[model samples]
Target: MGVIKHQSIRSTLLIYIGFAIGAVNIVFLFPRFFSDTQFALTRLLPEIAIILVPICTLSTVPAISRFFPYYASHLKDKENDMLTLALGATIIGFSLFVLGTLFFKDAIIKANIEKSPLFITYFYLLYPNVFLFSVFGVFESYSGSRHLTVFPNFLKELVLRLLTTVLIVLHYLSWINFDTFLWLFSLLYGVLLLALLVYLRRHKFLYFNFRISRVTRRLLPKMATYSLSLLGASLFTLLANNLAPLILTSSKGLQDVAYLTIAQYMSQLIMVPQRSISAIGLPVLAQAWKDKDKDKIEEVYVKSSLLQLTYALFVFLIIWSNIDSFFQLLPPNYSVGKYVVLCLGISKVIDMGTGLNSQVLSTSRLWRYDLYSSVVLLALSLPLNYYLINHFGLIGTGYATLLSMLVFNTIRYIFIWVKFGLQPFTMSSVKAIGVALVAYFGCIWIPLAIHPFVDIVIRGILFLAIFVTLVLAFRVSGDITSTIYSAVNKIRRRQ
Candidate 1:
């Protein structure tokens, strides 16, 4: 709990900072500075790489979290082969990816050539993009194994995004051509990869124990089975998530992809707390499962659900409250994504409200169930996305996302509840929602200023005032209020 508390706050803060920079980059800079087609390429390429990186790492990210305890218990600090295993696995996975890419290269180009020529023209850059993300993911996972999540989170959340902001700004200033911008952006992951490596080495967290331990050899069979399940789980889940944009890019065109991309970015704001909590939860949940500590796992489950829902609702309501004002800052064509943000925001709220069920299932004895869940996700998402986008256009993509996520989260929720009797709700859960709604409705009617900025600030301040006061008064989240009290007590003690 202490680790979750300490790290989640910092990680969430840094995540928000990254999102702030990202908001500028995505919401403001990219739309105006880059054309629709160019912006679409930026969004799709990284998305494809994100899906590819997990495959290139053989899903070692989760494997590292779930198995690191075994390595730690059996070997000395520098003698554990976790780092060696992760790095080796990703490189091999990347090699296999290269082989597959050679065969599918023409097919990929042909698939996109009709509607998204920009993506095809820049197709060569995707490999480097994926390779960098692949290695960076490996190190990030290994570092997480050491319970060293903060630095990696910093590098990924803060450093990478800041660099991106700079790159976009550089482009905005016409310092580089679009081709060079695309190339530099792809290579940016390599820069972060280098930074993570240095951070690990300096912290003495870098170790190569290529010598396989008795524990690893014995656990190898179980791990192979676990990895295989998670491998499909990872790919299906990633592919399902990236499906909307990919489908939209190939079927509709890049301009529509650009709108979906911005809306997705906005929706990601609601998920900032989920990212922080999940990253912190991985190693924590893994260790608990390793010890067969149901009590610890449930404590994390309930508290995390409450805390995350609180933060998620706050962010969501704020975004929902000011979405129109925010979009007004963007180009006129971008405003059509209003419904995209709504549908995606509600889906993320439900997703976060369900807490760390996915992590629990993945790390627990019932780990293989994740494979079934992901298969369902892809099975549903593929057909739904294709059909809906072909029919409803951009908002149709949003509808598909909402439906797919609803089904996906519902399946995982049922799995956790039926199998383990753990659920992520409490009385405070309802109270939190009530508080968010009250605050949201409370602020919306206040007059709109002529300037979008003024409207945002006034409504934002009033919304925070109402939301925070009510949350504290009602004790909607004990974790959050307790944190505030603890900080205040420390301040009084110092005085």
Candidate 2:
């Protein structure tokens, strides 16, 4: 928990910084610079790659966290065949990925041409995008297995966003046209992959050890079984999360997809804390299981839940409360995504409240449950997406995602509780909910000014005052209060 907390704080700072850069890109730069179709292409490319990453990496992402402990603990000098297995699987997966993309090219183009014809022009870009991200995921997970979490977060969050901003700015200045801009955008992942490779080499974690002869054939079966199951789980989860963009691009036009992308971006901002904590905590969960330290794992689980819930509620309220003002800062066409923001924001809150449930499960002995849950999520979400998008338009896709995540998290939560006797809720959980509601309602009566910025600042301050005061008074989380108090004391001493 200590290490998780320390790394998570640093990672959170980096992620938020990245989010700041991304907010500028998504809110101001893209809308102001690129046309709607171009903007949708930018967002959709990543979404497509995201949906492909699981299979492209052959589930190496979770495999590293789940199985690395066993290999390192048993093998000499903390060495194992994990990387060799992962990389080998990835090469084969990449081959298949290329073949599959080529085979499905016509179908994909035909499907999107009606509504998002511009996508066909850049369709080949998806292959490279998927390949680069697959390599990145493999290395990132390996780095995480070594407990080198913060750097990967920096690479993904800050460094990548920084690069994206540069490219977008270049595009804005007419230094590069749309095709070059889009290609460079995909290459950002390649740059990050190179950075990660350098990091791994510096740390001497980059050595490749097949170790086929050392480990008995018996262990091979276990490894294969685990990887296959996790691959299914990872694939399903990715599809569920990233499929909305594709569905939107199909049912609605690319412009509507652009709108949904903005809403999704704003909603994802609330997930910084959860993402940071989970990134650092997965390996910790794995180690705890290795040590048979159920108490430590439970501590991590509960603390993560409480902390994320508090942060999630705070961010959601702040964003939603000022959502109108935030949208006003964007172009008028983006206003159509206001409801999308609400739906996705609420869904992210639900995701946060579930804490590190999925991480804990994936790294624990009950990891197989993740496969089942993900299968259910995919099965439920695809049809829901089809039906909802047909009936309700763009925002319906957001609703589909919201409902999918709700069910997905609920299933994970129940399984954790029943199997491990672990749950994230405490008396403080109830108090945190109360605090959020009070702050929301109490600040609702504030008058809106003519200037959206002024209204946002004033209303944000009032909401923060009410929310933080009640949370501290009620001691919703001792960790949060102590940190605040400690910072305050440092300031006082300096004064």
lDDT of 1 at 355: 92
lDDT per residue (tens digit) for residues 50-119 in model 2: 8788787777778788777777767764356777778888888889988987898889888989999999
- Collision pairs in model 2: none
User: Over the stretch 111-176, how does candidate 1's per-residue lDDT look in tens digits?
Assistant: 989999988888889889999988888888788777788888888888988998888989888898
Candidates in order: C-alpha RMSD to true structure = 1.5, 1.7
Question: What's the true lDDT of residue 267 in model 2?
Answer: 88
Best by lDDT: 1
| Model 2 stretches with alpha carbons more than 4 Å out | 77-79, 213-218, 492-495
- In TM-score terms, candidate 1 sits at 0.97
> Using Cα atoms with residue i matched to residue i, what is each candidate's TM-score against the true structure?
0.97, 0.96
